[model samples]
Target: MVDYSTQLIDGNGEFNVTGLDNFMKAVKLRELGLSYAVVAIMGPQSSGKSTLLNHLFHTRFREMDAFKGRSQTTKGIWIAKAVGVEPCTIVMDLEGTDGRERGEDDTTFEKQSALFALAVSDIVLINMWCHDIGREHAANKPLLKTVFQVLTLQVFVLTPLEHLEPVLREDIQKIWDTVSKPQAHKDTPLSEFFNARYNLYATIKQANWDASKVREKLRRDIEAHASSVRSAKLSEIVASFEKKLGQALAAPVESLLEASEKDTWSSIRRLLKRETDVGISEFSSALTGFELDQATFDKMVQNLRDYARSVVEKKCREEAGKVLIRMKDRFSTIFNHDTDSMPRVWTGAEDIRAITKDARSASLKLLSVMAATRLDEKPDKIENVLFSSLMDGTVALPSSQNRGIGDSADPLASSSWEEVPPENTLITPVQCKSLWRQFKAETEYTVTQAISAQEAHKRNNNWLPPPWAIMAMVVLGFNEFMLLLKNPLYLMALFVIYLLAKALWVQMDIAGEFHHGPLAGLLSLSSRFLPTVMNLLRKLAEEAQGNPAPEAPRPPQPLGSHNFKGQTQQPNTVSSSVPVSSVSSNISSTESGDEYSSPQLTHRRVSNVEQAESS
Candidate 1:
């Protein structure tokens, strides 16, 4: 009983999209979809077009009052739903044609409105005065010509028996023949172009007698229109649903595939099922008005499920194509970053062999996950086979190595896996073996580089000589040590020389410099040794001449606190007042030359000298 009415177009030829939308919603016209029918009325000014529609379709379109005299009434196209009609008819009342308000020069709105009515309406009622039926200048003639040119459908003339002459029908036929036709339908007859012609009064009496026949015709026409529209829209709707599902599901599936957790495939299956179900539900709701058969509905739903699986398969294939890059990335992530996700320094303490094993295992797990589609929720031996055959190198030995011992065939020699289907497999066993080989080949340089760095770190931190070398020095230099101990001034001079040598060593970072190789270290030392020694001598001479000594250098900082470029801080110094006494005490207390001359012990000895000077 809802009365929904809206002006569809203004007099200025502008369409009222907002008003139309509101009217359509109010009338629930969209709910009908293609099942609805449209009926429109168009004729000359004051031809009672609106009055005829208001009576015929039970619409409340505004009609001009006879007492108010004839003029423009409906300014534009007005749309309203028919109160009671089969197949939900919508009616439009177009503005009157050839009005004095818009002079004869402007038949633009008339022609445009007529064309729109013919294009959209299933039934058009052209209301004209009975007196203007055979007149050459009848106002409805141009409207009929417009309809004939665009389309020729069934026509019903509503006139009295007196005006329904044979010549009147001849004039209508002449108008159709004279109207311009597309080349495709130029020679087509009017009867072939249109469905049927009926005199209104006679047909109404005939319809009253056999109403069921008339109803059947109307039903057939509605079904034909709805079927054509539904067929075209069905494909579009399914395609749109598929596009939406893919857009929503692709990224998350790719991410989960990359992660490859324990339940990754299960999680993906759940996700696909959830999304597909939602799509099917929404698609079903959208096609409810189409009244599709059960088989068609089930087929469409199955197609959606198939599309979802295809999307997963496509994503798996894409990830498989980039498996090598992902494997290398996984290796680098585990190898380069520590347990806390910090970059590894290869400080000689880390177990590179165990770390390489773990990293390869993780990469292998990624390969196993991507090697096949697991929608069946079944586990495979991809990981175990790959690890044992490729990583552990447990393949069959060559004939020479076998030496009459029986051995199993290589597991990775086959192009497929046991108990796995061809469609489900993305990467076969042989392909995985080849990929692992390439992965190891690509990552070998990183392992070698880590080993080199660890070796360098060990070399740079080794300042003291080996225990055997220390024992040799103690045995070979025992006589010299005794000679220096007998002469106190010789001992002091040796102590002073030792202090100078230690200072130069700290400043130059001799341990770090020698890490490259002994030859490189010696070459570097030879180049800079003399100039450095000359500079030290000049400074000592300056201090001896009573010039204030330079400030003492700060103690060496902890590892990672110092600059990485081998720049070392200068060593601590002893007070000049107790230099001889402190040197004698240090030499007496020292257990061995190697221990006493070490950088750590040197710092402690200087700290003791400073404390003694303070006390």
Candidate 2:
């Protein structure tokens, strides 16, 4: 009259297979098939095996009463449903070894029961008393040996009672050391055999009984719903996380930038570390709504961290770009502007070496601000980007020599006019310094061009006609007014002035006096006064007559204004007097309103008015 719900098999190797079916049915798990895990427990007689299973699984397996004596309580295998675990767990209780009534022949029953449990179970628990660890027939040893020899499909876990001496746990390690020998294969250990057996059992179980196909189905389910997993909602979550990270970083990054260049990156690294921890924790909590398993959730966390890092890095680069602009402006301010912040019109008097050296130092200091990234993970990359961007061209040079140096430094300057470096970051200090030297060279070359431009402008603004042309206009009587008489004296004076000017120009060219230096500038200035005085006299005579003064010539428009038809046309005339001062203004903000007009150009208007009064 055995209770089928409690006892799955009776003594004498009689397996109550129907008892197992009935118990599973009562628990509503028989039809569930492979949607559950099977656990079995075995140990020495009265080693609290039944009590342990009852407490652990919350099952009603009968335990032996100490007063009634130490007889076997579980006669065979007792199966029951686990109370608290997920997916319907079925726990199997095996008969204890060293039975008082049974003799040595009982080993046959123990081995058969263990084999049966191993065949059906995924995990088997081996329980033993602390005192029995080193005993000859330490019940667990023979049972474990039987399972190993038989190569049963189960993973065995040893359960050591806390009431036992701590030293007894050493016995478990000792036993494993003795039993974990190579099986039939040279390098194969006993654990490998057990693992292979367990995997085979699981495969068979899945094929015959498991309707859910748990592992395969989980994989396919994740795959089928991958788009949903990576949905626009998830993207929005990532973007939100990035926004939070950015907001967290903005204040600190700005504070770091306001400091000295050397301090900026170091401060940013510290700031990033502090903010990243808080950001990751918050982001992880938000991800829990997706209800993913540990593995999937951890993978998503890693991807989110990677994305956040990239976004932060991109922002850091943009900030670095702004810093680079500030740095270049600092260098240019020192090199191309005076203490008054006026644009430098490079006269030969300025010290080229001192200005360039200061600019170089400032540029280097600016570069040092971007020596590392916020993570300090990609210093080389950050430095390279900053350096490349600073020296990248904004304005093209005007001369052939300038173009030559630019071509050597940057091949793309002519096409895109942007000089970015190739893929790899600049690594060594030598490499960085070398690039800096090229940049310094370009700056110095630019300064030289500026000086040459100013010099050319000064020469053109005070330009005079050739000595022969002046003689023709003054002495040959090809003037705008009617000449009543030919004056031979005036002709002689003009001839003498022409010869002097021709000699002076030839001598100046031979000595390179017009090239530069204060003496050369003075000489060039003195030579142009004669033409200005002669033009004034001629204008005065014209206005004295009833004829109005000829309109002053206007500068030609720039090259792109109109198409050329290869014709010379007369200069346009107008009734209104368009003074050069009124046409263009060059007043500096720092200057007094009346102080900085374009006096050289304005002098033409004044000469016109004086001539009108004199006439």
Candidate 3:
């Protein structure tokens, strides 16, 4: 028996969102947030729409008084907060349609009120007497048809046992009997028509009403309502969960990274799985408060697991890089220092072989740490994929080629070694030194870039107070001692210092400093020499252009030799005095010198004889 203030719209049908706002405030809708759900009822005049809502939700919405003779007691639309629902529920009582008071001619208010309720409510109850279901002009039918056009409407039967539990579905024959009438082939009997429509409707309706499907949809709707009510809260919860997962993973990965290279691989696989399980377990526990259905819960669990897996994979690689850094540190330490950590003064007597062996061993061990990236699969497979990614830009040199001390090898020397060494075999100290140097350079560069980016971001965001502010406070503050007047020299010195500092800060290029380093001086020298180098190259190119490339010699040609350079004619040794008939007949033998005087005349005689044969 909770008291709820009922909100009403007057009979004129004039309402704005402000009315809804006032009603929401009265119901404490803002306080309920996403935990609130709306239930609306629509039915004919005097059909117990408000009465049903009052009983179901423990709301005291105004109902019609039979003694007073009903004349749309609930005019327009009415709303009240539910008193006894699990979630914060708002019950909407829409104006009844086809009222005797309003008459059938004007059902505009009824339609408008129904639309308004349907728009705002999570679930709508279409209240109708069992007898009125088949009637064409029933108030519920018109509203249902109207709602069907706009909403994804589903039918559910509420029983005395529970609120939303579905009743046993009627048999096809029983459904047909209720919706149909027997007629002697009256176009197609009304029963047949109803049965055809019923069959199609049953497919969609049954799917929605299935126990599992109903539960899933309800869970989704609940989540949707909760999201709308408290979107910020849910976002905060998810962010908190992600933060916890990251924190949980930090320790194991850090511990694995701190380990000696020889022990890193096996330990990483174990630690990665353990930390991933922790993250997923924590996320799952966090979701329990939402009270999701089994399907949704399982789906969320899988999604979290996948997220954990990706995070684990990335973290494993990063931590592995740390191990490589450690190995490089060891190699550098051994190569550059004596047993006492003192800088080495290289001498002829020093056992270079022993020192080099130790350095090589350390580098190899570091590489081994990188090889163990996968938790459940083979190490070699993970090694291949990881090395492929790390060495994506690297081009391997031929096995026969050995790089000099100062010369650069492949970015990852590991990429150049196609064959994995046998357990007993070892790579040379020179190779190890080259590889370690490259790896160290790459890791240091990445770290420097990351630090620079973070610094830039901080500068942009200005998380801390600027340095000038402190100076300004000291110089400009109201001091009882009158510090500024008493110390003119100090003020002038401060001004000079500020101007100098501003000039330097404005001109500073931190990123350029990192990228260029000691190379800046050398770069400036190169820039000065660049024009001289280009002019020298141009002069050399001009001098080299004096000798043109010779043409290729052509092959020897046969006589008549149109293929020769100048198309030379053979000597006309035969006499032209012979008859044209003889010259034409003997043209083939003329090359054997049967004396056709002119070669041109003999050719013309042959051409004339050939043209006559064609005609």
Which candidate number has the best TM-score?
Answer: 1
Q: Which stretches of candidate 2 lie over 4 Å from their true place?
A: 1-6, 30-35, 147-167, 183-615
Q: Write the per-residue lDDT of candidate 3 for residues 1-615, one digit (tens) a residue.
A: 655645567778766467778777766778664566777777778777676666555577776676777667687777777664556777778877778888877767777787777677766666554445445566255555555444333333322232112222232233333432337643443243221111111111212233344334544655564565455555676677666666766666666655545456567667657766776677677765565679977876676666665566667556554554666666677666887989765443455556655665655555555444434544243233234334333444445666677655543334332343332113322344455567657545533443455555455444357789877886778692377679998788889888655433332322333344447735543443444334334434544774323222222211221211112234443335555543222112221122122223433223333446758
Candidate 1 regions with alpha-carbon error over 4 angstroms:
1-222, 395-408, 467-494, 506-521, 527-615
Off by over 4 Å in 3: 16-22, 68-70, 153-306, 310-370, 374-615
Error of 3 at 261 (Å): 16
RMSD of each: 13.6, 23.6, 30.7
Model 3 residue 469 CA deviation (Å) reads 85
Tens-digit lDDT track for model 1 on 53-152? 6656667888887778989999989999876566588889999887889997888889999889888987776665677777765636766777777765
Tell me which residue pairs clash in candidate 2: none
- Provide the TM-score for each candidate, comma-separated: 0.59, 0.32, 0.36
lDDT of 2 by residue, 202-254 (tens): 21121234423433442343333334435756789878987887787776675
The lDDT for every candidate, in the order shown, is 0.75, 0.57, 0.53
Q: Show pairs that collide, candidate 3.
A: 33-229, 34-229, 574-596, 574-597, 575-596, 575-597, 576-597
> Which 10-residue window in model 2 sums to the lowest lDDT?
197-206
TM-score of 1: 0.59
Residue 567 displacement in candidate 3 (angstroms): 22
Candidate 1: deviation at residue 236, Å? 2.3
